[model samples]
Target: MTDFPFLGILTLLPLVGAIVVALIPRRNGELAKTIAFVWSLAVLVLTIVMWVAFKVGGDRFQFHESYAWIPSWDARFTFAADGIALVMLMLIAVLTPVVILASWHDVESSPDGAKRSVPTYFALLLAFEFTMIGVFAAADVFLFYAFFEVMLIPMYFIIGSFGGPRRQYAAVKFFLYSLVGGLFMLASVIGLWVVGGHTFDFAKLVESVNSIDQNTARWLFLGFFVAFAVKAPFFPFHTWLPDAGGAAPAGAAALLVGVMDKVGTFGILRYCLPLFPEASRWFAPAALVLAVIGIIYAALLAVGQNDLKRLVSYTSIAHFGFIGIGIFAFTTQAGTGAVLYMVNHGLATGLLFIVVGMYVARRKSSLVSDFGGAGKLTPVLAGVLLFAGLASLALPGTAPFVSEFLVLIGTFSVHKAYAVIATAGIILAAAYALWLVQRTTQGTLNPALEEIPAMRKDITLREKVVVAPLILLLILLGFYPKPVIDVINPAVQATMQDVGKTDPGPTSVVANGGAR
Candidate 1:
């Protein structure tokens, strides 16, 4: 919408930073980390500036820039941000610095990290930062797709090179699954270009979709839907998440789930619905079914998880289910809530993953059985984990609570049966979250832990620095979600209009409680 090229510079900054990081002397690992953190902080500050400059009521998509990249294919280096994309970009900014700080000691602390290439790890983090920004900020479909596939590579290297015992296996599976999804997305992109007058401009494609038949639209929609569904990791596609989340270093996992996985839901909201409205409606029933199944299934899996990291991973699948309900419900309240949930999930689950990592780092294990009565030794750590669990379960006064409530009530009006089934996941959520808390923090101390002095030490100042902001945001958002909701409302309205659906009207009842 502007000639400012704000987004182009913004997107390019991190790639420049990545190259700078890669240039840092390999022996100066500490310097590499310091520079990476400093660079991320700079990006964060610029993001704040960008957020301040974003006139919410101005153009529907602001700070847009476009330059022809492939004139024949009609693709361009297009980038812009609506309210939804803006918030996600802000989230990427906020979390990147935190992940960098959290990974400060990652290489030095791990047993398998002897092979961890310090410069490579930090460089990849910076490079990954580049990809995350590009994916969310991209306006051209082909551009988005290119960023989409590029984002996966850095993460694959990060996990395989710097992750856990099963790093190679986890990395490969994650890559192949996502790679297959990318191919489907590729097909859809090509299909859109051909049927869409050989153009990949998003606005043009939206208009072009009308020229395509319903049958062809359905096939194209499936290509996109399957791609997102896999990335969203709905049900059967979800098996890779646990393995990857558990195997990656905690900081990386936080970014992986917090921001990267969101690309899936983001793709659904930004691309799928508007491009193929009929297909979206036709698929809503099945998507809702998958959402409910994912909610219940993933929650149950979390409850049975013995590995703390994997348990946290399962919890995300369940949360995504709630997000799916909100998005598919086709109401402003639910859609706005889904966006809010995405932000809160990043905060709450990101915190949970970090805290779990802290525990694992000290105790040298992630098993629930490896910890008991830990509160007595490290009350601060115990308390943080408990707070994180409470937030995860959508405790009445937390950020997730507000979003989850919106999602449920919104879905209830439209799909009562699915809403009820999804609500049950909350109970299952409580069981897993609280049970994980109690088993790890309360009761008799693990006999083996008493022998390890590291287990007795509480969270250090650096760790506190990492967690406090997220905790503060969770509580603040719970009490007042208006800021985010305001930005999200118009975008959701646009999407609703594009989908040709309106929020269900309220039933009229007379003063005497009679239906009118």
Candidate 2:
């Protein structure tokens, strides 16, 4: 099983699909969509097979493959997955097909007169999937950086070519922000290669970087951290996200908020902490402050958003704050919770974004003020919207609740002040999410919606098919997180070992027994 090059095949399959999709005749638009969807489905099935075959007790980096690439720079075409990467891969697989289906008529609805091409759009989507897989699966530092940078191209085209009226502006902003971040990462990668024995492999760098002096390690750490912070879009750097996410086609926004943004926190986990442990610990306090601030600030922003799509984007920023806290807390429980939050957030928020797109599709507006008492007309859509909102706010029965709870509990043990402050975001989340539902779905019926033929109709069979699996998984994982935790635990434990940290016990206990 280990000899099968599964990770290599998984990474390249979507790129191959993109090529095939692009070759289809331009007139055969439906054929192109079908091909793209089928290809995404195929990738999904293959990923499932790999997931089933993965052993919880196996080596940390499984399905490993490495081959010579840049001999002079001592880089290789390396690919592998720890439990963390595997779940992220699964997330990519699961979301791609759903995104394709939700985006089936996305280009047709836009009246911006840009002459969007469906093949081009779908091909770009598949190409983006290729980059998503590659970035997560790459074991070599240089290889990861390559995939990271290349991902921006397809997404940039997706937004610029097929998005809203201001798509060009949003796309350029997204590109420039990411490009600057990439430059920061590039400098770090070069520094890491030189200082850590001129090799770009992750395992080797981890061992070699230990000997470097404190100042050198912290500088390298900052280079990587700044790039990831921009990607994470923490606090001040996050301005690009609402614009880009608001202007992007809903399907792309789903991918953007749901899965792609996780890359920043993922990079922090996979690269920064392991490669520079002392720096990671030294910087943890500052990172926690930023994370906690982001939580409260982004939640407030979400509460105030007029555009529904942008509102969803703001919610994600708040969620990312929780993930950051979990990671920098430096406990296995918190780290594992962060990883789980990544997967669960993808599922919950992906469904929410797609649902918002559906609403926008019917009303031809993304504004909260544009809707009222939609439940009276389209009960099912209203119901789904409410459910998605609840999930976003971390309702007890939903998958996100489990992960969010874990993150707070884990953080409280080490950083009670940060943890206590961060919990306020949950209340703000509830306010924004429910307020969104109230503004769009409840109250007096909107007379204008009746005039729009599409608005009166409920979510169709195809839409139900798109959201059902996500709904089921959210509930399923909420109750039975053990399946995911089983695989994620080992990798997190390994990370704990790499950073030389242990879970801190309670300082004292008071009950019937006296404190020792």
Candidate 3:
């Protein structure tokens, strides 16, 4: 472990930036925005350096740093990065700047249609980024819980204060669902202390908790599982996603779905399985069933949606189901694919939200019916939207395709039935994505929209700049994911070993009846 507190600095830099932005006079909105963007970019640069320095195939938690916060309770402000956390941290760092640029003109307005204070808006974004980094980097269980709960506050305000017309309802709903989940997790956190000695350090908990009886461990696991499932918003608990996504500002929605919800899956991989291995295995079947159902059901719902933002949100729910399947499958390849899926999903869905936001900005509506022949008016924007949509559907030559393929291949090795059923989501994904393009860009121009000056214009240079990096990443990762896969595979293998599982041997045979 290094003595340098790189992880702590990475976690706090955004918070410090938020403070500075907040202190800036509200009258200087542009200055505040500039400062916040620069700070977020600096955070990205630091994260890139951290990535370069990370020692792959070494200690599970690199750049470890710890300082006792409550000695009696064994609580500490500890932080580190494994391959999974590093990937998520990179996602947060990359998306924060892209979101900042995407929201350059996404001003909040009063009921009378006057623009409100933009400084507070950007400040909240920075604060949200702070909690996001903390959640991924925290090594102590209590620290993780604190960051987890604190993250909801900024997102709640972002949605309720700056979102669409039903912002309050959506925000409150999002808050309540998340609060209930967090409360369930709090109970589990307390239970861990009581059952596994009073240590809140994740490493200590994992070392000590094996003595817990099966029934007790299962209950504890359920407590954490419910919270994660709700956050994952799997199946029955997923009603909040569409409402929240549809109502939030595009940047906020992107982070909400793209980066923040990932904590749920990350928690399951990081805390749930290692700490409650037997219980995780015991519940695997039930979890897999829900994951499959979510995959099929959400995809069907997405196909029926006419609202563009809500459609995109539904697609996310379905994709998360694929991630859930990968995680629970207990194969190293599946686990690596799940983690990779988190990164790719962020890029593809973030681009989709950005493109949709551009359309909404021009048309002032997200209804699919409100658009027509937009491809003719803005060919570059249309092409980007099509590419993003292809990525969302896991088309060949896209980042998602590689990840999704690995997930299915890995799952098929263990549970062929589940893998087969989950594949339906891909076809449904194609349906919804192509339908979106057809309705919004292929038909004759909507007469109502044709009269609008903004609707007639092409994508702006700023929008192109904001989207270009994500496009490049999707293509780059699609072709050469070895760099990420190499880092991920070792961590995933370790996780599977901890869970007492291993991938089954390939069963296919050659024509001569020899193993291939």
For candidate 1, write residues 261-362 as lDDT tens digits: 999999999999999999999999999999899999999999999999999999999999999999999988889889988999999999999999899888
Note the Cα lDDT for every prediction shown: 0.90, 0.92, 0.92
**lDDT, candidate 3, 377-492, per-residue tens:** 88889999999999999998999999999999999989999999999899999999999998998879778877889988888988988999999999999999999888788888
Off by over 4 Å in 3: 108-112, 508-516
* Candidate 1: regions farther than 4 A off: 1-3, 511-516
Report the Cα lDDT for residue 205, model 3: 87
Clashes of each: 0, 0, 0
1 or 2, greater by lDDT = 2
Structural similarity to truth (TM-score) of each candidate: 0.98, 0.98, 0.98
Model 2: clashing residue pairs?
A: none
lDDT tens digits, residues 1-516, model 2?
677889999999999999999998777889999999999999999999999989999899899899999999989999989999999999999999999999998885456555567888999999999999999999999999999899999999998888887789999999999999889889989988888998998888988967878898898999998888888777767989998999999999999888888889889989999999999999999999899999999999899999999999999999999999999998888889999999999999999999999999889899999999988899999999999999999999999999999999999988899999999999999999999999999999999998999998998999999999999999999899999999998998888778879999766767967763
